[model samples]
Target: MPTLEDEIRRLMADETARLHAAPDLAERVMRSSRSKRRRVRVAALATSVAVIAAAPIGYLTVGSVAMTGQEPTISVVPEPPPIDDTPPVPTEPPNLGDLGDGREFGHVRVGYLPERLQWSQRSVDNGDRYSITYNYKGDDKGSYRVQIHMYEEEAVQEVDDQIQAYRGEEDGEGVTVGARSGYLVVQNVGEDGMKGTPTLFLRMGDRQWAEIMFSPVYAEEFSSAEAVDAELKRIGEGLTSTM
Candidate 1:
């Protein structure tokens, strides 16, 4: 027995109740919105990652153009010093002529010799001084002779055609031996039973000196005066003294 106004109000109340939300409906809607926003942010981050990862590949594609203004670097190494492995050259000895065997005597020795000559067995000994004579083995007339004299004391006067007589002879020819200071004389001696041959007088030291008178035998044997001179010097150099 309700009126029409009461019926209409009851219908409006039913419709309002139908449109009303549940107690946690606003919270559920808020959570759904937050989840959608989070999904969007994740998608944006993935897209940014893809772009960042592609950057190095893009740079490599344009690598030559990017390095166009810069020069390429290079490494260099220096060369080492060369080694010197060559051997040193040796020096040669001097060329001197041939010399014969040695003959030793009183206070002296003759180093080189002439062939076929022997001691004449005639020697003169005067207290502390001596004289030795050499000749060809069978030539008795004394055509070629070598007389070597030695004195114990220096500056002994000429006794029996000895020291001073030969020391004073000069024929304008002078010679010097190596490392020995002495006077050498070559005299055109006509005496001593010789055939006017040449003589070589080498007087050195209180030593053995040969007042050599080879005579015309040597002059005939030699080709020139210079040859005789060279032979004379060779003889003198071969003479060595003990005193």
Candidate 2:
């Protein structure tokens, strides 16, 4: 049997050993737990950081792609309308003479002449007649000349023959003059080697004739064969008796 003080000492030693072992075991467990926790925290932080960075990048990339795919719109402008401010001009009928009266015998178109001719009066068959003479200043001043005559006639054939002689053509040939019963007279009497046609208008009683002579040459300058025929027809359409 052991003494009392010795037993007490042995019990105290065993108790101290147990205390030290308990502390070491607790320290080991705490260290393992702390390491595991630290690993989990690190993994979570890395995942969160990756998610935050990729989110902004993905958003910006999508926005850029969408903007790039869109097309720009354009605006169109319209043109203005045109304005008309001019007045309308008056026009006359082709058949009617410029005088516009139905009573006139005929009309004469006088062009720009270097000089005007003097009018002379005479008696033909106890009826008054008019003569007009002018100097044609042209290159062939001597060969080309102009004369106009008006007379009362018992018949128009004689005056027609005279006009034919003047025009250097036989009467009742080349071209006819006037409308209805008028006279066609062509003359080639110019000092300038010029030729012209002077048409004559006659009254119904075979007692009146109006003559018009052109210078330079009617066939070559003042009037063409076709134009003379047309003018004569128009004059005859407006013919009236002056006797």
The top-ranked prediction according to lDDT is 1
Candidate 2 residues lying further than 4 Å off, grouped into runs, are 1-127, 131-149, 153-179, 190-192, 201-203, 217-223
Q: How many residue pairs in model 2 have overlapping backbones?
A: 14
Candidate 2 has an lDDT of 0.44
Ten contiguous residues with the weakest lDDT in model 1 = 58-67
| Candidate 2 local lDDT, residue 16 | 52
lDDT of 1 by residue, 95-183 (tens): 11122222665566776555566666555656456655567768774434555555555423443143345555533344566544344
Instruction: Give candidate 1 regions above 4 Å deviation.
Output: 1-102, 141-143, 154-170, 184-197, 206-210
TM-score of each: 0.44, 0.32
In TM-score terms, which candidate is top? 1
Cα lDDT of model 2 by residue, 1-243, tens digit: 997645655665576587755534444555786688666666655554555466522221111112222322322234456688888889532322232221221222223222332222211122345433344334342332333345555545566567556556445343333334455555445677555455544434455565544444533543466665565455444445555
lDDT of each: 0.54, 0.44
Error of 1 at 233 (Å): 1.2
Candidate 1 local distance difference test against the native: 0.54
